[model samples]
Target: MSVNIPDKGRIFAKKSSFYPSSCVTEILLALLGIFVFIQLFYYLFVFSKLMRHDPPTAAYAGAPEGVSVLVCAWNELENLRELLPLLNAQEYPLFEIVVLDDRSQDGTEDFLKEHADQWRHVRFIRIDKEFPHITAKKYALTVGMKHARYPLALMTDADCRPIGTDWIASMVGQLGPDKEIVLGFSPYYKEKGLLNWFIRCETFYTAIQYLSLARAGWPYMGVGRNLMYRTRLFFEHKGFYQHKHILGGDDDLFMNQAATRTNTSINLDPESFVYSIPKTTWSDWLRQKRRHLSVGNYYQRGNKLRLGLLSGSHTGTWFVGIATLLWGLFSHDTLLLQILGAVFALRWLVQLIVLGGINSRLDRTVNWLSFIGMDIAFFIYYVGMSGLILSRKKKVLWR
Candidate 1:
């Protein structure tokens, strides 16, 4: 199917028969002008609206619901050993930690058996190899959910640890009365490197977009680390049936299909945050991102278009805006150059305001000087990013 966007006059100009070349030039310039304006409007209107959202602060009434922390692990012997003790030590009144050891060979089953067999609240399940051809991660997640004993099921990766002892409590607090899903922030622990900076900045931006949109009654997705939704909602939605064949959607695609504005809630309590271990190498980070990008093809059409517009206009802001400015300078068009310069400054100012606050909120440092440089470099960055999306051969393993 072809897309037919509604065209308005002056902005969407048509070429003339007699002066076709000149009309074409005018049309291109007008389109560039419209594109830059859209970029400015997006930062000012669409994304910057995130600044208005506040953290979930209502007192959680009554006794908080018991949570079944469902973790799916494959060869996460080290992580499980370190985090399980902390999970059990939560100060919350009622909760259980359930882990699925999916055919792990690195002594994961042995580690699981020692504690799960002895403790009442801690549980573990072993899944042996099967030939029926199923997405291993989704299957493991489903098994954990089926065996969950509490009303709410909280999911976190084996490599993740709660930000604080009250992590479970803070996440549970957001599900108050009618909220079925609680979307929480998950930030990677800061390390010393440029890659770490990029990872942190990306995480902060993603959180701002998802959290802000959720607050605006357009909830879309949540992170698996520190994510909670009712067990009933899981079974009701048939536990990843929507995109079960794909391995990575256990967190996002499920949210894309199941979340609705009224039923979903967000918890921005720093206490509710989950800290994930960032991949130390470029290859590792690429594989992790490929897993995420693979699921984009399956998002709902409207949501996909929303992202396309957001990225496209962002791209246009750099390439088209620069080209327009260069053309004005070459032609000695002072008025055109002046207008473009003002818009460029305005856009940069707004980005600094919005992104600076977001960085602070997520405990990340904001480099005021690097803001423009990074924004410009992202044009080249996205080209490689698009390639990662297309290279679906790299798998997202739970291990």
Candidate 2:
């Protein structure tokens, strides 16, 4: 029982060794809390809009309105061959498919000329030359819209095929008198590769944001693979004249500039979906994404802020969350570790529920169990794409 009085310095050191520095722990805890709050806000408040959405039944009171299906093709001869039959077979009346061939050297002209009589609803316009100032895709789209026969214009890529024959009717049914822009869903065909999974998940997440935000009266963008609007809206906005010099954004940039809460509508009908062929290689996919994201800088200030917060918080949720957990473990603080675990668990639980519902609603290919992995992937993707998105120097070509 030699209570040999230990030095005061030794006692202080022993206590300090039991836990990490208070300042570091407090700062990390505060950051973790904030990031968790932001993550929950998006899942609960923002994404939940899509989760809870109930698409109206496809209906029309009168003769099915005429719709001009715009397909812009450059080197999409095979795709057009596969897609034309489907477009001609759509279970809708008075819909025309206008294919604008943008100086294709790949026999697209020959193929269309050969089968022009077979595809009754399909029509093709060969663009012999390119506009020096305009991007290829935008120029083709502008020409297609100008030649659109119907008042309503439905756009899809040449590489995309509708899931069902009712695609036009389902999408057109959403356009009420007040709605001018109709945003439709487009998913990549299920292929056997990790790249395919990533592409599908990325598309799913993007659809969630744009479709959900559109429903929330903050419509920002739409995918060209499956999108629709009144031809009047395009001409009124000068048909991509604002950003014609920049590649990509033929769909999104136009939507960002034209879509409004009252005029925009979203069609989630599975039949309305158009499935496109995804990029098989990483380089091809990266180039495609670079073009897609190049227009982000031109988004409306409010839209940019909204998307930035959502993406920034998503990135912080992983980075700050992991850091906090590591610190808690290092400090040997059971309470801190337990709190961090609970926060992460809660966030993931919400994510699973919300995103799971979305997957089931849109593309059921991605397993809910893979959400944690995809969340981490998205974190990496956002961080990686931030620079490319910010840089206005990289020239993106739309082929």
Candidate 3:
């Protein structure tokens, strides 16, 4: 009826005089640090294998059978002029280019009209009404989608430039008989300094996660810069119906509702890539990220859980690494410090390797150390802004 408790003397005896309460705390912190490093290592291993066995590029001749391309523009007339010519030069046959002018006060409508005669496939939709939601892109896309004459619809932004003449062909070619959606890679054009390098690095990292998950049969999202889906699938799934009340999540949320393992894919072929201009300013980038993070609330529970773990891993590593370093400095625990350094080095090595692979994959040049600093900044900003946005009901406006 009564359970025996361990003798206090025995318990006390097991505790080493050298292992003070502070030492115990330090030891626990060190173990936590090790755990984070190990988990990250595991992710790297899995991610590496996914990269190794990525699906080969699909080869479909001519234009995508029954497909239409949509580009949405606000005040990007000059960019659109460059982008339109590139679109016109695509090798794809039997496709049309439709641009939705989101009530641009700039000469965007005039530019489209001038070019409409020059390019037969070119068409324009002028959205005169005020954008209904913070997700202005989605509203414009919806209007464009209605005008599409084909069953398959592809969406890209005005700032994106196709990598090759076969860009459209490669993307459309990936649509298997049963597949309803295909996510394509959107890399960035090179830039001059650390910010640009960091942007590319961050973009590459995002690509790795999305591409790996797509390979793993859990395709959750795609960038609007180079994304394709069946026109019917959009309407069938109610077309961002539930998440429309929110300001973000046109891509991921729609993909969340519409994509299944059998119906989704990633087109990683070099020819299928599209390059977009990176945000030039840190404030601009932060706003973009804030809009993106606002939609995290709408992800499927499984995805939410995965993302939570990923965030925790980064947060855990930073806290544990700093705490352990302080412990080593204050307590002079050389062994503990060595363990922490070893873990940090290993994590950095894995990240560097993974990042190198990403860089090579995207043809980017990154200052690895500078990228680490940027990553930390991003982590802090994302956590803080995301927490604020998710808790508040204010609609996110694109700056």
Estimate every model's Cα lDDT from 0 to 1. 0.78, 0.88, 0.77
How far is 54's C-alpha from truth in model 1 (Å)?
3.1
Q: Tens-digit lDDT track for model 3 on 86-183?
A: 88888876788999999898899888777777987788999888655536777877888889999889889888999888988888778888888989
Locate the minimum summed-lDDT window of 10 residues in model 3.
Answer: 390-399
Which of the two candidates, 1 or 3, achieves a greater lDDT against the reference? Answer: 1
The list of candidate 1 runs beyond 4 A from truth reads 1-29, 116-120, 131-133, 332-335, 365-370, 391-399
lDDT of candidate 1 over 1-399, digit per residue (tens) = 999876666344643333654464476567776777776666677666666657576345667677899888888999988888778877788899888888999999987777675655688889996434558888888888888888999999888988778888888778756789999888888788888878776776678778777777777788988799999999999988877777687888988988998988888677787888888898888877777767778888877877777677778767777777776777676777787788778878988987776666665544666678667766766667887676547445644
lDDT of 1 at 236: 93
Best by TM-score: 2
Instruction: Tell me the alpha-carbon RMSD of every candidate.
Output: 8.1, 2.9, 5.0
| Clashes by residue pair, model 2 | none
TM-score of each: 0.87, 0.93, 0.87
TM-score, predicted candidate 1 vs. hidden true structure: 0.87
For candidate 2, write residues 1-399 as lDDT tens digits.
Answer: 678888999989988865557777888888888878887888899888786788788888768778999988889888888899999999887899999988899999999999968988988899998788998888888898889889999999888989989999999889887999899999888888889989988988899999999999999999999999999999999989999998889889999999999999998788898998999999888888887876788999999998988898888878887887787788777888888889888988999999998888886857787899888899999999887666665555686
How many backbone clashes are present in model 2? 0
Candidate ordering by lDDT (highest first):
2, 1, 3
Q: After superposition, how far is residue 235 of candidate 3 from its true place, in Å?
A: 1.2
